[model samples]
Structure formats: structure tokens, C-alpha cells
Target: MSERKMCKFYNLNVPDRRSGSGDGGALNHTGNEDDDRNEDEGIQPYVPPHEHKLEYSYWMWFSQRPPTRDLSTTTTGYGQALRMVGRMGSVEQWWGLYSHLSRPDELPPLSNLHLFKLGIKPMWEDPANVNGGKWVVRLRKSQTGRAWEELCMAMLGEQFMVGPELCGIVLSVRFQEDHLAVWHRTATDLAAAARVRDAMKRILQLPSTVNLEYKVHKDCLRATNRHEEEMNHRS
Candidate 1:
């Protein structure tokens, strides 16, 4: 099936009416009287049938409504991560979460935010991400707004790093600058990683003056200093 058809297969919106009027003609005197009688009898007006149903397969777009059940929200970071992971599968639901979330540049400095698939944790310890790495794009403080937004859109829209190899993406905002990373499921697959990085560069359309880097999760965790020197030395 075509991409548009695939998207529509998952989207359940009511088809629009072709003709303006129904089978019945304009109201006559007799019909007016019947309508008045119906109103007097407390008969309700007609409501069109809802085309969509609430199911696991469908997700809502950019909704502010929190999960109704208590189980989805817990004290642990892992629990919150789990909640996020569970909601990432359906396109509709992913859109809903996207709508409700704060845009990357709007987050406070020194804040770390992660968006990943339901089963995948943003951290390295998760099975899906254990041997994985991330391509980091460090944006100047001024470019945070546009860069972060484009990166988030590219990640969530599946415009980059196609297939199951993509785990998630993360953004870290700091006083000096902001950092964006696309996390993948395997670090050993250099070809796949290169593809992801190239896709990212194309999407962002960065200038030749700007530089981007990719690092393994293990190396990042072991780094004592958060600087270009440490990163270069590790590479």
C-alpha cells in the first residue's frame, strides 16, 4: 500500500457527506408540525456515529489529558520511562503525546529530556540500548529553538534512521549550549550509524562550519570531562 493509504488505514475519521441534503425534501407544514410534536415528546436529535474506537493500536495527537489509571504514573524514573515507552507505538498516540509535550527549547537549562520507544529506555543499561551509541549534535545556545524542533520532528516522524534499529532521541539543554542525540540499538553497525548521521545532517541542513559527533554510550558514561578534548581522545 501507498504511504498515504497506510497512514489513512490507521486514521479513522468520518467520511464527509457528498450531498448537502438527505432523502427528505425541504420541511413542509406537516413536517413542521411533526417536528414540534417530536420536540415536545423529548426525542433527542440525531448524532452521527463515531468512526474511531479507543484501542491499543490507535494513539491520540498532542493531548494534555494524563493517563487516567494510577499504574501509569509511579515514583521511579524507570517507571516514568516505562510509561513513556508503552505509549510510543501507535502513530495517533505518539501525536497525542507530542501535542502535550513542551517543545525542546522551552525546557529549562541543565534539563535532560528523553523521548524513546516504549520498550527502549533512554539509558544505556536497557537491553535495547546496551550496546548502542548516539550521534550528538551540539547546537549553539542561540540555535537551540530551531535545531531542537527540527531534530525532534525528524526523530518522532521516523524521517531518520528507519527500521527497528532506532531506539530513541534525547536533548540536553545547558547554559552554554544544547545537545541533541539520536540513540540507536547497536553501536557495532557502523554502516547503519553512518546512515543515521547522514540522514540527520540532511534534515538539519547544517552549515559546513558546524561540526557533529557520534559516541558510544559506554564511552560517554566513562568520560570524566564534558569537553571536545575528551570526546576527541576517546575517538
Candidate 2:
């Protein structure tokens, strides 16, 4: 089946609602001070501070303005901050950001654009992604635009992998090559990860000669260091 059709099938299988209604409003009973205290002592429910409407505005503002060099002053925080701002946790805002942003080839080498959910850092060290990994597809420098566009469309269109386990996608541009990756929260979830990778391969229509690799975040960190060492040796 086609990638789009497969996604639709999975969506249909997802349960529409919870099976049981146990303690449905237990956390929202304002009068129960003890319950509230207990809940607070435990884990607080996730509430996104930024509004989706504001995120859309920010995305448009950033896209229309030319890229700035002085990130320290121009952007209050690092690259991740921009990603967090754009990831407003709403489908509408996410689509808006993707539609307005430039593709990978339009950006300079070593530049990256991460689209992760709000409150989740793109890095592996983040609590949400500590045990995760990414399925990577490296493209020749000439195919950067093709690979980038295909992966971005698959991700934002929710065609790559569309479950809660789907963390995000990343595009990394290097001097000689570019990479498109789908980040997942669990590296051990082979079935889910395989589905994601298959979706990517199909959408990108990768050449049979190209070999895609799935790397755990821990492994990637090590591989990065090794590559740096090799580059230094060549120099």
C-alpha cells in the first residue's frame, strides 16, 4: 500500500477514547485540596505556556526576516529555542511554520532545523529522548533538496510516523552531504521504528544502491566524535 494509505489505516485503528472513565475529573476537583496537593507532589500535568497563535506570528516574523549571523544577540537562546517556539503543539501552527520556512538546501551547511514537540529538547540527553534514536538517510550533496523536501513533507504531513511515539524530524546539512532523520522516543520499539524508516524510504524513493542506517543517539554521539577525529587526521 502507499504511504498515505498506510497512515490512514493506522489512524483508524487508534482508539477514539479511553476504555474506562475512572477518576475522570479527580484532578480537576478544585475543592479537594488534599488530592490537589498529592497531584502536585507527584507529576504536574503538561501545559504548554506559549499559545499557538503567538507561535504562528513568530514563525512568520522569523521567516520573512533575513537570516541573522549574531545568534547570541538576535536570538535570545540557541537554535533549539527557535524550534521550541515553532513547535507550538498545535497542528495549525506546525503547518504554518513548515510552509513558511526555507528548505534544507536554501540554508547554509552545518545548519539544522529541528521540529520537535514543545517542552521536548531535540537532543538525546533530554529526558523525553534519553533512550531514543533516529533513522538516518544520507543524501548526496546534489540530492539535498530532494531528500530534504521529501522528509519534511513526510514529517509535517504526518505521513512518516504518526503516533505518540513519533518524536520529530531533523535535517542536517554538511559540507559533502545532507541527512534527513526521523527521531523516535524508543530505539527498542523495532516495529514502530521500522514502519517509520520504511515510510521515509518509500516517500524519498531512495536508490537501491543507497544504504540507510538507523543509529541510536548514544551511537551517534560516538560516531560524531570518530568522524571529527578522522577529519582532523586528514587535515
Candidate 3:
């Protein structure tokens, strides 16, 4: 069965739209007031006893590339090393988690923040993602935080109209450039893919000058594997 059909059959819940909400856009390493405020803005995170439930539960995963590791071997260990930051089923819970976490700018190089639906792991080999691909937007270092925040808000708000086709989103932190990618269920569905791409561009307020690309999971895996092979040969 197609991924979309399967999702509908199971009645998987994505994020719900927040009515009449404006996007307010995250880090800190110090103990000073400025650092404290910057990290969480003094908003204490609270979990409700039994109210304000979200449409779906989500998991947040964090990973940082290991130093001196070969790219091919990286996936295995990297996947293993991913730490589950938290799981939330409500807006309060998400806010609590988001408030305490380090901002994307404060993250170390090669770090990544992944927010995927509760049951799906953020990996190319995962069943939900194996048949999928990502719509990636390259951004300058200065632009990463706002774009990430906007994208996250949009996802949690269910602003993207493609039903079931949307899987998750990722923000990758790099040395010189950062990337934000939207994962979807099928690479072969050009129409759905186009809609998703357009939604992302519109929701994220991406300018025409920004660089965006759609890459199938298989092709992405191939490219990484090829790079790993080259690195191994050089060693």
C-alpha cells in the first residue's frame, strides 16, 4: 500500500493548526541573567495534568557528528548516538522542552535537531522514510535560527496542507552553512512533491534567492556512501 493510504488507514495524527497565532521566534551556555533569559526567556515549562492536548505526539532527537569518524561508518554510530531530548503530547510540553534546549546557533558544528512524529525515527533507512525524500533549503549561518523556528511553528501548527505526505523536518548545523529540510513520504509523486515544496517555500517565507533542492532518500544515501568510500580510500 502507498504511504499516504497507510497513514489514512491508521489515522495518524499530525500537528493541529493553532488558531490566530503569530510566529514568535531560541540559546545559551552561561549562568548570567542574559544567558538565562536568552536560553529560555524566563518562561517556565509546565506539563498539564490533563488538558490542552496536541493532535499528535512528537519526539525530538539530537545528534552531533563524531570527530575523526569516516562518513560510511558514521551513520551506524551516529544513529546509535542520537539522544532523545524529549517526547511531548501537548503545546505546554513542547514549549517546556523547547525553552530549555540550546538554540541552533549555540549548537556545535555538525549538530542536528530532528523533530519527527512519535513512532518514526529520523533516518533514511526507517520504514516511514525509506520511500521518502527531503526538500532542503540552504541558509546562511545568520538565518538558521529564525528559519528553524518558523519551520517548526509551521509544522506544529499544521500549516502545510499536504496531508499524510509530510513526514518530518530537520535542521542541520554545519561549519559554514546550515540546512533545513522537510521530509515527505514519496519521491516519485511529483505533484505531491511540488505542493510540499511550494508549501515549504511559502510557510518559511523563503526568498527566490535561497537555494532549495529535493533529493530522494536513495540518492542521498548513495552520495553519502560514495563520499565515505572516497574518505576510506584516502586513509
- How close is every model to the real structure, measured as TM-score? 0.57, 0.56, 0.73
Question: Residue 100 of model 1: what lDDT?
Answer: 43
Worst 10 residues of 2 by lDDT: 56-65
Candidate 3 Cα deviation (angstroms), residue 165: 1.6
Deviation (Å) of 210 in candidate 3: 1.9
Q: What is the model-wide C-alpha lDDT for candidate 3?
A: 0.68
Q: How far is candidate 1 from the true structure (C-alpha RMSD, Å)?
A: 17.0
Alpha-carbon RMSD, candidate 2: 13.8
Report the lDDT tens digits of candidate 2 across residue range 1-235.
2222211212221111123422111122234434433333222122234523322111110111124433322222332233222222344444544554565566655556565544455666667676888888888878877777676556655676446677767777767888777888888888888888788778889777778788898676565556656655777
Q: After superposition, how far is residue 35 of candidate 2 from its true place, in Å?
A: 34
1-235 per-residue lDDT for model 3 (tens digits): 2222211211222121122322211121123523333343222223356646656566676766656665325467667656544456677666766766667777777778898776677888888888999999889899888899989877777788776778889999888899999998899999989988898999878788876898999887777777777776898
Name the best candidate (by lDDT): 3
Candidate 2 has what TM-score? 0.56
Using TM-score, give the best candidate's number. Answer: 3
